[model samples]
Target: MRMLLQIAFIVAAGYGALVAAAYFAQAKLVYFPAVGREQVATPAQMGLPHEELTLRTKDGVRLHAWYVSVPQPRGVVLFLHGNAGNISHRLDSLAMFARLGYATLIVDYRGYGRSGGRPSEEGTYLDALAAWRHLTAERGIAPEDVVLFGESLGAAVAAWLAAQVQPRALVILSGFVSVPELGQEVYPFLPVKWLARFRYATADFLKDVSCPVLVAHSRDDEVVPFRHGERLYAVAPGPKSFLELQGGHNEAFFFVRPEWERSLAEFLDSTRPVR
Candidate 1:
């Protein structure tokens, strides 16, 4: 009985240490800007024409972006990527948007790719706002003709921006309700809700967003569970949609491209103003 108690004590101590480590290292776990830092490919490689842009945020951070254009564009997509990799890794998505006759403006958040500064929750929101201003102000794209498309962590940034700017539509792919909520889900054994330093509250922001919303998630997603998407959709206002995707978190968009394109096209059509 003494030996069993000793073993239990050791196990408890180890678990406590793990929770402490997770608490301190939360920022490192949230952002992955260092991964795939090299510029892998460009829009030209995918047979798409693009213009490199350097945007200045309100906080004076200079961000790098790519404006991939399509002829007779149905609309423009301001693509905010996930917490991982740089913009160079998102050429496939740019090409896909181009195929759908939507010009894409994908930006590397601060500290990712060619952009400057370190990654932070507030920094990402500022980075997204810079991209939005570039599209609406510099490029002369009307708010009614602009779509905010965010994946994973970017969904939170996009939703926050959508609430303020009132873009034509907002698309959240593999999104979570909030950082603390997701952390709690991912590390159920730990006190993740209290440990989280960042609060990218996507669902809360969705409540303020008046634009049409599309929440897509994959049941097989190993990273973010499908219920996050369901919850986000439930919280979104009217003219909202929930798309069921297949494959893991990263691969779901690529895996269901054909179906995604079809559904997205239909959804975009519905958002058009009736003459």
Candidate 2:
């Protein structure tokens, strides 16, 4: 009996240590700012002319962005990228938007690329607001002419901003309902719901958004799971469209570019402001 008690104590201590580690390292696990931290390429490499922008967040963090403009753009896309790499890695997306006749502005969150300061849930939201203000206030672009496009972790940030600003449309690619919810799904053994300090509550943000929404996801998304997209789409109120793609999490958008672009054009066209 004494030996059994000793074994139970060891097991309890091991579990406690795991929980403590998860709690302390939660930010590092969620934000991958170190992976490909340098800018390797730009829109010019893809034959697209763009202007380099430096935005100052409300909290005084400086962010790096690129504004790629096309002739007579149908609209503007405020692109928020995933957690890993900087804005330089999204040249393909900029080219795609240009093909669709839309100006693209993609920003690197703090701590990624040349941007100053570190990333946190609140900091990302402020970074997004800085980009929005650059377009709507500084550049004098109408709110209705800007489309908020987010991918993976960026989807949550865009959703939060869309709720506040009510842009022309909110587009989410491979998004999630919430960080804690996704954490639970990914780490079933850990008590992620309690350990999570980041609350990118995308579903809750969608409830407050009034603009048209477009959600794209793949059935074979190995990272964030298909159910997250399904739940996000369900939570959106109205005038929303869901584009189901094929392939893995990161590869789905590219693998079906032809089909995906068609759907994207259709959705954006439907939301186009009659001028």
Candidate 3:
């Protein structure tokens, strides 16, 4: 009996230490920005034409973005990428959008790519606003002709902004309901609800978004569970869609090649003005 009691105490103490460590290092775990390898690749390498853009946030942060234009654009796609890699890694996605006849603008959030400053929740929100300003104020694209596309963490930023401003369409790829909910799936033993700093309530925002929305996720996704996408789709009002794809989290686009293009093309078609 004495030996059993000692084991229980040790296990409890070890669990407590792990929880404390998670709280302290939460932000580091959330934002994975590749600092040094910023400008490694360009859209031109993929035989795509793109213009480099410089965005200055209202908070005075300098951000780097790429404006990939199509020959005859049906609408504009303002892309928000995931957390792990910089914009350099997203050249394929950008080229794909450009080839599909939508003007694509992808950016490096603050410290991610060649952009300035450190990465934070509020900082990314400000960076997204800068991207929006570049679209409307600089590029002169009408709000009704702009579509917001986000992947993972970027989805949160896009959903938060879409609540405030209306867009032609919104797309969220493999996003979660909230940070706390995801944390629960990942670290249920820890106090993630209290410790989490980034709670991306995408389902909450979908209630207010007045445009067509698309949520895509894969059952084989190793990172975020597919239920998140389903939950968001359920909450979204009319004209919302949920795309089921194959492959892991990162490989969804590659695995569901034709299906991916078909789904997005349908959405873009809806946005295009009728002749």
RMSD of each: 2.1, 1.0, 2.0
lDDT of each: 0.89, 0.93, 0.84
Q: For residues 1-275, what per-residue lDDT tens digits would candidate 3 score against the true structure?
A: 99999999999999989888998898888888864445778988988888988899999999999999888788888899888888888877887787678889998999888889988888998999999989998878888888999998888888887887878889988888988889888987788998887777878877888888888888988888989989989988868887887778877344128778888788778766555
TM-scores of the candidates are 0.93, 0.98, 0.93
For candidate 2, write residues 1-275 as lDDT tens digits.
Answer: 99999999999999999999999999999999999898999899999999999999999999999999999999999999999988988888889999999999899999999999999999999999999999999999999999999999999999999999969999999999999999998999998998889989999999999999999988988998999999999999978999887778767245237877899999999999997
Model 3 score (lDDT)? 0.84
Worst 10 residues of 2 by lDDT: 250-259
lDDT of 2: 0.93
lDDT-wise, the better of 1 and 2 is: 2
Which sections of candidate 2 miss by over 4 Å? 252-256
**Which number leads on TM-score?**
2
